[model samples]
Target: MIEMFGLEALSNSAQAATTVGIVFTEAIALYIGYGAVTQIVHQATREFLGGE
Candidate 1:
């Protein structure tokens, strides 16, 4: 199934490590993205509410 994507045949441990690394990388990316969006919305909301 995996090889169908033209990926090299990695061992089980290697595959697991690769999956974990990919997930960790994506988690960090999503966290940063959401944090930035939240900050922007927070600032906008505060200004709309006339907060200093």
Candidate 2:
């Protein structure tokens, strides 16, 4: 896709760095998203069970 964007001059190291950065960012996003969903489910379950 980067090459398709006319960035054929982009170096291999730059591409590797960009890939790593993107993976890291996506991992963080998924972690945060799942954490939020888990918190919501936990709260609902607790309420249903008559806990605080």
Candidate 3:
């Protein structure tokens, strides 16, 4: 199944490490993306809601 994804055949430990690294990268990107989105939306809403 994994080979279908075009990754080289890796040992179990290597696969585990790669999975962990990918998961961590995804988490950081998601958090940063959402945090910036929320901050922008919050400021825009505050101004619009406050009529300022």
TM-scores for every predicted model: 0.85, 0.79, 0.82
- Report the CA-based lDDT of candidate 2 relative to the real structure: 0.84
Residue-wise C-alpha lDDT for candidate 1, range 1-52, written one tens digit per residue? 3355444588888777777787798899999999999999999999999997
Give lDDT for model 1: 0.82
Over 1-52, each residue of candidate 3 has an lDDT whose tens digit, in order, gives 3465555588888877777787798899999999999999999999989955
Cα lDDT computed for each candidate against the true fold: 0.82, 0.84, 0.82
Best by TM-score: 1
Cα-lDDT of candidate 3: 0.82
lDDT of 2 by residue, 1-52 (tens): 5564465577989877776777798899999999999999999999999999
Best by lDDT: 2
Question: Comparing candidate 1 with candidate 2, which one achieves the higher TM-score?
Answer: 1
